[model samples]
Target: MSNLLKVIALLSLTVAAPGQSQADWQSHESILGAILEQVESNLRHTGEKYQIDVAPLDRRLQLPQCDRPLTVARLPGTRDLGNISVSVRCEGTQPWSLYGRAFVRLSKQVVALRTALRQGSLIAPGDVELVEKDATSLHGGFFNPEDVIGKPVRKSLAAGTVLLPTHLTTVKLVKRGQQVAIRAQNTVFEVSMAGIALTDGEAGQRIRVRNVSSQRIIEGQVISDGTISVSP
Candidate 1:
């Protein structure tokens, strides 16, 4: 077993009094284990390292043996680590329920700005940095350097500000400096040319495209990530 798991296992024997009889009462150890499992399930594939600690159940409570299996779940709106409330319910012959508390600390390196930037300013290599933060404190989504660098800020942000997808505006169709296929079509025939994108392009937005064959630049509407269609 992992050191962390071993420690938590050792704690299972320490709760209540040493000689206290738990034969007739609901097992507090099992309840804590269930909460840990639920949190681990949620953290799977998240790429964040975490630690968990659950409060020991009160020894004075006369919790009865649950004839059926216990059901455990994190309460609504309490999914984001830190301090969380969980419900442990028994639906056996004599129904019973109790609230438990646990703390989850999740950590990950996220992209943030090194200096304050104004809205619409393009991000440069020196403008951004990576920092470790509690993943639980972040809402929505976070970003990496590659996701934010060379992109324009949607609004002004202060130094050390973490970057989220909502903070940046990027190519939905075409990106700057990328090769694009330009197509022109008519009832008689159709022609296509290779071009270099001069700026990011969006649907119905005008963008400059440089034709590789003629070495001439023309405007076109974005059709796809690598395709731009022009009017004849």
Candidate 2:
């Protein structure tokens, strides 16, 4: 074939190539949809404009609600959850959802439950289990302060208060010798050390403690002053 002809053919092929597009989220979208419905239910059922952000599907979820400006550049389905934005903020009904349904709120932010627990909110009600490592932020963009609010805003959380947001995957007690433990359910954790309960150890609180184990005062949460069990 003539070189000119070959060049023309290549150019034509390049132009004719099919372009790729975002995929549908499908059921994943449904879950998020449900969450949004919940928010609408609480938000007095009015559509509101909110922002939404999404993380890479593979990224581990850290926040409670999806980020703002939802994107689906990675997954399939125009309506699927695989490709959407996290950190979402939208305004519609108090709680809104597609077929999936979700709830949202304008005043209350859907932060990680772990963050709420840290803030000293009771983990009951409004708390939901994380489904997978790769999921949309939240189905809805708003929430009712009353329904989604954590336990009373604690000026400080006692050591024994259980930690939520299990993804707090990386927690290091700062004190060199402080003891630490994971408190859950309603049981008082066992004291793991004898070091001076650093930082006024109290009930349902995690404080920087010095670990008496190695005589190194390590930062630790005071599950319950001197009487609580410390996770070994």
Best by TM-score: 1
- Local accuracy of candidate 1 as per-residue lDDT tens digits, 1-232: 2344334334433234445476966777887787788777887778778888887766545566678988888788886578877777778776677677788899888898999999999999899888988887787445568776777899999999988889988745788999999999889888998999999887668899999999899999897668888987
Q: Rate the local accuracy (lDDT) of all candidates.
A: 0.79, 0.35
lDDT of 2 by residue, 1-232 (tens): 2344234323322121244222311234433544444333333543333333321121221112222332212122333333332222222222112111122223323333333344434545455322222223444522333433333434444432232333222222233334344332335443333555455544455565444456654444444424334444
TM-score of each: 0.58, 0.20
Which residue runs of candidate 2 sit more than 4 Å off their true CA positions?
1-79, 82-150, 154-194, 199-222, 225-232
Task: Give candidate 1's TM-score.
Answer: 0.58
| Cα misplacement distance, residue 4 of candidate 2 (Å) | 29
* Candidate number with greatest lDDT: 1
Give residue 154's error in model 1 in angstroms: 4.6
Lowest-lDDT window of 10 residues in candidate 1?
5-14
